[model samples]
Target: MWSYVGKKSNPRWLWHAIDHRSGKVLAYVFGRRKDEVFLQLKELLEPFGISRFYTDGWGAYERHLEALKHEVGKQNMQKIESKHINLRTRIKRLVRKTICFSKTIQMHDIVIGLFINRYEFEVSI
Candidate 1:
């Protein structure tokens, strides 16, 4: 998903992979919406042994993930999309046109990272 830091023009993308069965986040990365950033998320998911991937029709996913294991459509991606909604609700920084926003990229990632670790993963850190 796309979020802004410092200003509306400065965009950053949150890339995450979640397990369909458990509805648990496998890994996440924050960066520009580019192939390199997608590759970084993919690398993080390598250890999870993910066989199938359901995602939107993003060019990077098509280029990086195996064709046979990739499925593109909104229908199959409902869980992740719902997760995004919940994230935006809980993390005000993710909401568009909000007064609550991080002034720096470092702070943006740190706040979201803490939320995910505490709530999503049930980790104290």
Candidate 2:
């Protein structure tokens, strides 16, 4: 998902993966919506031994994930999408309005990361 630091024109994407069955975020990386960013998230997920990836038809996923492992369609992505909605609602910075915004990339990532870690993963930080 995309949010911005300082302004709407400067977009920073939150590239993340979720456990398909549990609908919980597994790993995430923050950067521009580029293949390198997605690759970083993929690297973070390597230890989990993920056998399948259900995702939107993003070009980065198409280029990186193998056909046998990746399934591209919204139908298979409902859980992740719902998680995104929950995030946008709970975190003001992620909402698609100017009411609240982060001023720095570091803060943007840190806040969102903390929220996910605390809320979804139940990690004590």
Candidate 3:
């Protein structure tokens, strides 16, 4: 899981992405939803070829997940939706902000990358 304090005024949104089959988080990026977020996501997945992508209604996925088949809409991507629920429950710091994040984007990348690694080896349900 990854997150960063945003714009000084917005609540921190922790972003996380996991493999549906293995339950390993592939990548996470934080900061106000922007092009850079998608860029980070792309960088994370570039090493591993992605056959398909499942995302929520968030428009960012639409703009970024152009190379692969993307399944949007709630009904189309229930697995990812359910995985997010687990992510929120397990990563309380991400959801509740008990820990204040560094204002810098670099810090966000480091922390988020660490969290993703922490869960990377786990098997999916």
Q: Which ten residues in a row have the lowest lDDT in candidate 1?
A: 116-125
Q: CA lDDT, every prediction?
A: 0.90, 0.90, 0.62
> What TM value does model 1 have?
0.96
Ranking according to lDDT, highest score first: 1, 2, 3
Residue pairs with colliding backbones in model 1 are none
lDDT of 2: 0.90
- For model 2, residues 12-92, the per-residue Cα lDDT tens digits are 999888888888788988999999989899999999999998888879999999999998888887887888899998998
Which residue runs does candidate 3 get wrong by more than 4 Å?
Answer: 1-8, 96-115, 122-125
State which candidate has the highest TM-score.
Answer: 1
Model 2, position 90: C-alpha lDDT score: 91
RMSD of each: 0.8, 1.0, 4.8
Tell me each candidate's TM-score. Answer: 0.96, 0.95, 0.62
Q: How much does candidate 3 score in TM-score?
A: 0.62
Segments of candidate 1 deviating more than 4 angstroms: none
Q: Rank the candidates by TM-score, best first.
A: 1, 2, 3
